[model samples]
Target: MYRFTGSWLHKALVRLCASLLAILGLKLSAFYFLGLLIVLGLHREQLLG
Candidate 1:
């Protein structure tokens, strides 16, 4: 397991990476969004620390 630490820059990079991945490949886009769903919603605690 991993936790996203640091600051707002990390958050921006995550969003940037999400958009970039979505634009780069179809398969990656699917997996990235699903992971985003799991991280952003299902496992909110991971980001709070």
Candidate 2:
């Protein structure tokens, strides 16, 4: 019983860490895409001008 409880806690921690990492990845990608859009927008004006 004790071993089971300990293993469950370990699994829970692993899952929490995985979820946090996923959220961080999403945020990083969003920021990267936004920066890319801004850069593209700037280049568009230069190209059109």
Candidate 3:
């Protein structure tokens, strides 16, 4: 019936959304960590020079 299909579709949509957000979060965290490393490197160079 329509109700069953609707519930299934809703569940699928929620799962898709959760997966996309998780991927996005991982990329963001990686970018942040990379930027932090660059900043630390610059700071170290400044201190040494």
Give per-residue CA lDDT, model 2, range 1-49, as digits (tens).
9999999999999999999999999999999999999999999999999
**Per-residue lDDT of candidate 3, residues 1-49 (tens digit):** 9999999999999999999999999999999999999999999999999
Best by TM-score: 2
Clashing pairs in 1: none
**Poorest lDDT segment (10 consecutive residues) of candidate 2:** 40-49
How big is the RMSD of model 2?
0.6
Model 1 C-alpha lDDT per residue in residues 3-48, reported as the tens digit of each score? 5445566899999999888787887778999999877875677666
**Candidate 2, after superposition: displacement of residue 9 in Å?**
0.4
- State each model's CA lDDT, in order: 0.79, 1.00, 1.00
At residue 5, candidate 1 shows an lDDT of: 48
Question: What lDDT score goes with residue 3 in model 1?
Answer: 50
lDDT for model 3: 1.00
